[model samples]
Target: MPRPGSHKYDIKRSRLRNELDDAGIPDKRADELANEILRNPRGLRARLTHVARRFVPRPGRRGT
Candidate 1:
């Protein structure tokens, strides 16, 4: 049997993939992107910012 949080993680990952699909993203690509975001230290926030950046431009200058 999986650990306590493992099931929750699976549910969350599945939900993320489903949301991506609902947004019209291809299944394979969505899965890949979801996995990438989940691999990040701040997975949920990283996923949000990744999607948000497509519609919202950064406020700061382009280059430092």
Candidate 2:
């Protein structure tokens, strides 16, 4: 039997896979990447920083 949060972990994994797919990553590669990220201690923070950088503009001159 799975532990109490096993189902939740599965759900989070599935969501990560879907997000990767939506970003144009192939299914197999997405699964691999998702698993790698989830297995890392700092994965969540790293992933969040990566995603946040996409939306948040960098402070710099108009054209450099």
C-alpha TM-scores of all predictions: 0.55, 0.57
Name the 10 consecutive residues with the lowest summed lDDT in model 2: 55-64
Model 1 regions more than 4 Å off: 1-5, 41-64
What is the lDDT of every predicted structure here? 0.69, 0.69
Candidate 2 — what's its lDDT?
A: 0.69
Q: For all the candidates, what are their Cα RMSDs to the real structure? A: 6.5, 5.6
Runs in model 2 lying further than 4 Å from the true structure? 1-5, 43-64
Clashes of each: 0, 0
Tens digits of per-residue lDDT for model 2 on 1-64?
2232488767777898899778766799778767766767477688757754654457883422
Which lDDT tens digits does candidate 1 get at residues 11-62?
7668878988787668998887766666664677866777767644578746
Clashing pairs in 1: none
At residue 40, what lDDT does model 2 achieve?
74
